[model samples]
Target: MRTLTVFALMAVVLGGSGRAAEVVVPADMSCRTEGFGYADTNRHDSSKLSVRASSNGNKSWIKFDQLGDYDLSKLRAATLTVFLHEGKSGSQQCDVSAVNDDVTENIKWVDHPNQENPAEEIYALTWNNAPGNLTSDMGLLDAAKTTYIDTITFTDGVEGQGFEVEVLDILLADTDGIVQFVLHNSPNLLNFATHDNPTEAKQPYLTLRFAPEGADHPVPEDGAEVDTTLAQLAWTNPEPNTPGEPIYCDVYLGADPNRLLMDKVEVGPDVSGVAINTDNFPNFGLLANKVTYYWVVDCYDTDKGLIKGEFWSFYTNDNLPPEVDAGADQVVWLGMGEDPNQVTTTLSGVTSDDGLPGPYTVLWTQEVNDAPAVVIVNADQDVATVTFSERGVYEFTLTADDGDKQTSDTVQVIVGDSPCDASHMSTGEPYHPADANQDCIVDLADFVLLLAEDWLACTDTLTQCGMLLPM
Candidate 1:
């Protein structure tokens, strides 16, 4: 990413907040666990109250119930930057609101979006701001754009309720796994809160609040573990950097990086060490071609509100596959070891070059003379299984297809004897009538055997032969 000038930032923030003394809503909220990434556009069932990132995606916006718990005087105006992982396609919108904790009418809802959402609103940033939450878009900057810095404030309402705005929401979605976020504050306020708190996952995040123009927004000093050149930026804050109010962080990302050639990039943990799952970061689907670039980011820390970090770069060998026996066996069992008795057998060892996830197929064979079975085709998951069944050898063939070609491997196993014996009946002896081994029936064969075997007493036990009732 290039650099951004400070002047361009303030205008974007002011333009979005609307009138300084805008009529806000009653909003107060406690902590609520939420599902993130891809949110839904549909309203909440309980008045669209329970809001989390749905398939609707990273599009940012806050939704909650509102009533009297909020005093507009207690609410201050602020500016927030919504950042997303560059090269990633999704929504990053601002959310703000005031929800009354009241039951029936509204409950468990609280928040305000930076900007209102339009129906046809195809947003690069789903900006929403309400009585409580504040949102801003530094707007979109080209990869060649320079670093941007800014100061914030609201014009009307009450002259000095001590309102503030720093960086707020900081989120980046990437086909590439990294995101960079930055926050700015007034020089008078020595202390400041980070716009957003740390998020889950290993994606890089850093947050900082500079003292009165603190450090020209530290640029990536070059030669680091991440590429500063490929990262996007955003933030959130109260009208000014105030003390003990709400300085929730909100970040975002857009399509802009240095030189602007990035389509998508694979990103996750260092990923150089994970071995158990076969494919690295399989769930996120973020991995890319081998390359090097720089990145910068910020995060909300327990101690430091938002501490900013410098840009760094790291190189990746994205083309290598997991280290497994390609020529050897391709199956692994669950509980059953060398021999499995009604356990599971999974096909393994089919992977790819760039390590994107997979282009693997799960095939099965019973080893009974029948042709192999096609279980799953083009599955991103590596292993395929043949669950518990009758005792015998089960074979699985894993075929890996990478676009233009296919690679295959097989694994087989033997099932042990049945858990229950079929030949014996409830009695301690083998299953039979009065004449054991008489070919299993009381026909002529058994009659002859009965005559040879026993004699006289009449008893319920078949073993005792009584005065014969003519068969």
Candidate 2:
């Protein structure tokens, strides 16, 4: 794992900066050369690439260019795919080599180099051969040569088949980005589709894979101080312009500058940002305040695997007060003769400390007021309920203490008088007749008061006895 991380870092610092790409073999870059002493015959416009032994051994060549600009030094792999249209014999062997020749698609049979010279010796094909098998006798050369690259065996009955060859070294060896190769059958004839084939999809092509580019444009800027522990980590894929499948990102974060002791967080191929709470890493303990933290993002091609990126660092802010958010002020009405507890309002507040290292305290306090009643508060919780015993405006403050510093916010509570207040009776205002005691409404207590005054005839001129009788 350590070695993998180092390699990934080097890739980011080196040439692994471009996206994966594919280059198709163009029609003008492919041609066939017949060896029947017909040196002047031009097969550049043929629809197929063929190699046969019947007519003095025919050979084919395909060249690919514009590959030098890519960072082939860090290339993961290079694949060359050719479509096989048909074969003349049963299981024919072919020799493929990276020859040092100045041949092009315009070269005619008479211009072919081997037309008058002795036929190129061929070698036998071997199974389970390592890549760049120069020692294997490909039957096309008199002695083993470094140019002999690979041997491909073709099945006679199968047609419209595709074969892939790993030609990474060959592509890297070409400094001009132009790669040329020659193919000849070991003994029999074999036909393969060329770039000019009617079926466009059957044309030969090359695919090169490299590590995904490093992360760019990070959030919060490197080597800066952040006020909050809940940092939003973000970065950009260096190869966003490269056309291919989505790339996956793995984020590594740690307090160590070397990033050896860190935690890994896997994100989506589509997501470029994630919020990480440094103070709340599961089972790893809270991140220390005033400590510098290091992080890096490693991107991967969903199909090709890890493409390492660079490392960035940032420092957590020094001791800071907790942030407090007191909920909106509340307005409530007190019913006549209602219990103070029944007329309660909740004072909601939210608090967050940059590095909540120890247990914090949340207290709700009521300021001094002129009302002749006590204010009861559920002081222990962040969201506390306050019961006002008198009708008036009350201000409550919520404070959060995180050992180092304290922060507070205020909320206003307005308690209004109810319409059924007993005090309104003395004001000579109209009131419900059933409210004998003028507390709120008619009830068993009012009936008891009326019974106490039963049979007390209205002898005074101010009393209306007729209305009180029986009715």
Candidate 3:
């Protein structure tokens, strides 16, 4: 278990209160307790901790302090990074519980008379179907003492050694500046690097991300292209408003970036997102394509008059050329024919375009040469069948033209008298002895056919000699 105490580090703050901020702190003290009811065994200064649940196994505790610098109420996200000392093949479950009282560096293995057992496990790890309960002598306590916080599951089979856990709600539940945690009852033995580890980088640490004071984290991201049909504006507001003093936002939007205040919309604080269509704002109508729109959200709280947000912009989708996929190259085997060897195969072509501007048209054209002419059915349709009359390669192109743009794709069709010949013509690969079934590619399929048909059989010497020519 890793506990991030903010007691000593006051210079770890990254940003101001107007924007998101990040704070990182490391565990201040950690110790492992023997599972047996011993009175005097403690490993406080070890560089590694062994956490498990057997009768003789050990449970660990981590303590962190100095979190009095920042207000915990504004914590948006919290994460804990722990490193495994040694790699393991499978996953294990380690139950993390919040300690009601702080544990000192000289804490013993046995529970004292007034030693308050850890409250109901805060995080019940799900591995090997282990129940969510504290099974250690020093960790056992009334299950109803605390409410269930969360369950965190992690896989131990990682290429590297570091693993992180989301502890936002877990940390928010602890109001006290000092944070303490108990690690016990893991399905498998877990060896974790301690705060006193030789490598500072491997020591467990915690990161906290705080939301800005005003509305932020706009949707669609700034400068992103959005669809006009489902256009909507959204943002995040971390500060909660009081019941009697509800918050209101004055949303200003316009196509001209310099004069964005031309249109103003007033919405309640409960509405985090508003649809940008004609139904909501008849004056704004459907947004024009390829046009950039600028907007800003000014939230008004009774406590703090009006807090203006940063101006954000996004471009509407533009009319794009039809995306064409003239299916894969094909191979066809001609049937027995005397005059002209011929076969027909479907050339499946597909096209997609933004229905802006107008409808689109499709055309199929073949490359004319001295070879026998190929006939295409419904040449204007996307998916059309083509007939090959000669044992040669034929090429056809599918072109899609929208009113604004046009695009094309080509596919080749190979015709031959036999399947193997058709495959060889399509691949252009030289035949090999290992291609037992006459296919151009020699893979495990050939091995399976060879093993199934020609395992161990001997021919008669007389027949073999008679069939051979005089040498």
Could you give candidate 2's per-residue lDDT for residues 115-218 as a string of tens digits? 33324321111111111222223235322322766777655535566666777777666666666656665576677777667766666666676643566667
Superposition error at 198 for model 3 (Å): 2.0
Give a tens-digit lDDT track for model 3, residues 346-433.
Answer: 9899988887678999988897764467678988999999776668888889999987678999998888877788878888887898
**Tens-place lDDT digits, model 1, residues 63-113:** 222312323222332233222212112322222222211212211223223
Q: Order the candidate numbers by TM-score, best to worst.
A: 3, 2, 1
TM-score of each: 0.19, 0.37, 0.44
For residue 137, give model 2's deviation from the true position in Å: 14
Question: After superposing candidate 3, which stretches have Cα over 4 Å from the reference?
Answer: 1-17, 37-39, 100-160, 216-227, 230-471
Off by more than 4 A, model 2:
1-28, 87-89, 101-146, 215-471
Candidate 2: RMSD to truth: 30.0
